[model samples]
Target: MSRRRPRASFAIGTVKVRAGHAREVGLPITRLVTGADVSLPVHVVHGRDDGPTVWINAAIHGDEVIGVEVIRRVLTKVSPKTIRGTLLAVPIVNVLGFMNGDRYLPDRRDLNRSFPGSARGSLAGRIANLLMTEVVAKCEVGIDMHTGSDRRSNLPQIRCDVDDPHTLDLARAFGAPVIFHAKLRDGSLRYAARERGARVLLFEGGEAWRFDEWAIEAGVRGVLRVLAHLGMIEPVEDEPPPLSLICRRSGWVRARRTGILQMEANLGQVVTDDERLGGLSDSFGRRLRLVRANRAGVVIGRTEAPLVNRGDALIHIAEIEQENETPGQAELAEPSE
Candidate 1:
């Protein structure tokens, strides 16, 4: 009987580390619809030795620019020579949206919702199709980065379905505080990735079209921790921040009446029942509505749009069982790295 060598799943192609041409390790899926020949940038790292493969991506929503910065730092700092198995990093997915500084593509389609994509569909759908077919179908794991839209800010969090133990493992390993354990939306990248037999963790932080230093630091460190956990690199201490607990349920506290808005509770602030989140007022300074937390939990997301309709979501809250789970005095010895 002849013995055969085990195949490396990420060894789909060789990465080009040359000048001008950037890198094109993976096979070309499709040329983007730009007037110029400039296409999406993809860097595939298939290490000489076999290990796990994790693809980290950012800017699915073009307005969410912090992840783009995060991926840039991660790619530049993570030497492929030191990487073990493989790391496929795509800093920007929605090129058109990013260029226009809009949340959706020119076609008004959300790329995140258009995935696992269609080759013969709209522009965003085509890009989604490319990612689903070419990149995601070949990866073992993934990390999709995101942020809150408009003036609303998100304290760094991992949002995913916690029903599966394996998915939970990856989420924990990713090491972001405050997880929103919720059901997967139909067309989200998480559902698409899961359909492709890979578990992906979505990191939500900061605000769209803005930069938050702490959120960016949390994102970059979380990616590094995930990479370390996947055995792509040796484990290194990150001086982990306060690891907020998992939140199983969340919803929005809508504006009770229409008027000018002033927010009280901030992102990541735990709110007890009946606590005021914010208050709405008329142009004449008369109070219109007082936003209150219906349940006790942390504020995961909110809307920054000052003008609001009666039913518009103003404050998004996540209900958690462990409201008091922050790192204690004994655990805060100069913040271990």
Candidate 2:
């Protein structure tokens, strides 16, 4: 018979978190202009029993704040004594951008695209390297939280490689409304982590800089359910998770005219091809054009901005396959990672 490996304290940086306990540790990032140090704060929960280690992170985009709250609430519910494995919670990864309410770092680089970075690289790259070396490298699974950029909003959804059987099972356990089979982008954290042999789930919902209550609630529930599925914690007593809508293809509908957009399509609402989604009009109230769906799918994301330029994405629709439907060839929508 195979023997179980001996358990030990979880060592992160210089802090050794003892088993059956939790601690908040800080990993130094840089020194501000005023000489004050900025560090990435992490909450480490080392469970009593042995199991797979998982890391949950938020604010990768800085402005996507909903996951911050989700992590906080999840921490409140999980005790090191009860959990079966280690849980690493990072509430804010882009501390510089988060402090300034900016999506990109002070160097104007998207942190999400600077993964597996060199220690001597740019600010974004260095931060990415710190996370990869100190946090991601220690985990078997990672949950990356995000939201729609700028004025866009997303329905609660899980973006991942659903073709992988283990990953697909975890996505379903997450209980999001939609499970999107998204391809990994180059230099993205998901791509980098996968390269290191870790399963990753990217959660997208709400919008930047605001707390959408529904999205926050769903996010909390989904994280807990994933923990349960991993056998790290006991199952939560929420409603049975949805028979998630599996989506393989998605496309964006753009505005044909530069004008004020009045949208009728709601997030998570299903629309048929050629259905009138809303209309566009000029400043004088003259109708310029009408926005319509090009395919039948669920409305997964949409622009909340009233003013839009020509060719700006107005609505995002995902072609879905139900649990009982036969899988078919389809393409996913192109959007920022």
Candidate 3:
């Protein structure tokens, strides 16, 4: 019979982040600087354990930085002594955009749009290739954190192709009150990973270039809970998780007429097609162009900026049937992680 390989272990300063020492460990992925063998800023935190090797990566779009911060806090408090398998936390995947405070690479290409990446292509494509090979290829489970575009904010939510059995369990274990289960897009990180037989989850919240404490806390705690479900972490006694609503359908509410927008509802609130979500006005607020939802559902996400144009995406909403029921609302407990 074949034997399993031994697990590797390590420590980080005062924190004991082990891969199998006890449970999981977080490792720092040292990066090499551009045009030199020297390294740039990049890191990972690995937990020690015999469980699954799960990777949580964030900041694919430099301006969408909440995940970077969220991963940082998760590392500070994750006790390597408690992890059962492995946890790899990568906070900044897009170094160039992160450093320059731009959403796209210097080539002006959306990094997230390039997946499985090009081994020989533009800077963004190259980076994507490196991650697919070195980081994601090694992981059994992955979570890519994100936020809405610079113009919008997203409520705390978990999105995945939940039709998959394993993914459905994860979306539930995440415990967010809102869930969007759908298909994968071409060339997305989720698509590439699934092709490799790894199930991944995408956590969306807040807006690009801005931070939401509530959303961050929700994300950190949700990830920990998922670890528990995967046998990678100890199960701690906790309050009942928020009841989740599955929105099998979601779409953008475009601007019918170009004008400045003033939103009436915040992210997470429910909306209908007949009701006014927000309205548009001339630069002087004289003539108004109203915006409305195309279907009935929750306002899981929306734009943050006031500027708008006809057909410009204003809100990214998630919905079920017009009469589909949802759980009663109870304020989510404060994030403990």
Candidate 4:
């Protein structure tokens, strides 16, 4: 007869959640200007059986709030009672920046770049340290959710170390429209988690500060799919998952002449080299320059802001083979500058 593994308790900060239950705990951050203590809220769901522990975190960049809605919807569909593992969900990580609708901490430091930080460091660093110690250290897998920066929109995509077999499998199971071979950025949460022996998948979709229904729905579905792949939940057979287009490299098309930018390309559009993507025109309706594709690729991201300056990134394209590239064997590209 097979033996069942013993159920374990999940603890973070001062709260402890045992098997087959869910709990919400607040991890203290620094105080505000008004001396009010701010805390990072976490929802933990611990299943009755033993399985892989996973964490889903959102709002590392406070302005990219679509992930918050995605996490909420995902939690609504998940319960600890019938699952086989623990799920840690943190809908808001940067409380200070989230409250102000800003992208960076009050100290102007980017929280994403302050990972595995020190307790005696800056505000962002301290928060990073807290998350690494209290949340990330306890998980074997993680999914960090994000949307594009302000004035930009991204197609639903999974970005991860595609060369790693296990990480690549999770990325494929996520079923995003695109799978990007994104390398770890210095000091980023993915990098830190990987250093601590955890495999992480970064999900990028929609735009900052606003919830896009398609992106949110895709994200919710993808998280559930990953959980199912991890044996934490039953498979969701809603629809056949989309085939992920793998991209080795991506480049940004920048505006040549500063003017009112009119983009002709959109997310998910395929373009060839020298294809006209847009035209820049002045306020008087005189065309200054025409933007063309520098390489053959599909549009994965684009700027929404009509007004642009010289060298401003106007479109993002991911380079993929028209044919012959197999899944899990695609080449990787260098991290974007």
lDDT of 2 at 61: 89
Q: Ranking by lDDT, best first?
A: 2, 4, 1, 3
lDDT of 3: 0.73
Tens-digit lDDT string for candidate 1 (1-337) = 9865543444333434421112444344345556454346678765655677678889989899999999888876666566777777888888778889999988788888988778898777778887777678878889999998867777678887788888777777766668778678888888989887998889988889987777888888788888887777876685644455778888788887988888777766777888987899999999987889988777777777778878888888788855445622111111211
RMSD of 3: 5.0
Residue-level lDDT tens digits of model 4 in 101-129: 99999889999999999999998999999
Each candidate's TM vs. the true structure?
A: 0.86, 0.93, 0.84, 0.93
RMSD of 1: 4.9
Where is model 1 poorest over a 10-residue stretch in terms of lDDT?
Answer: 328-337
Per-residue lDDT of model 2, residues 194-312, tens digit only? 99999999999888998888788889989999999999999886576665789999999999999999888888777889999999999999999999999998888999999999999
Candidate 2, run of 10 with poorest lDDT: 328-337
Scored by lDDT, the top model is: 2
- For candidate 2, what is the lDDT? 0.90
Compared with the true structure, what per-residue lDDT tens digits does model 3 show for residues 230-336? 98776543674555778888898988888888887666666776668789999877757777778877777777767887888887777753222453331343321
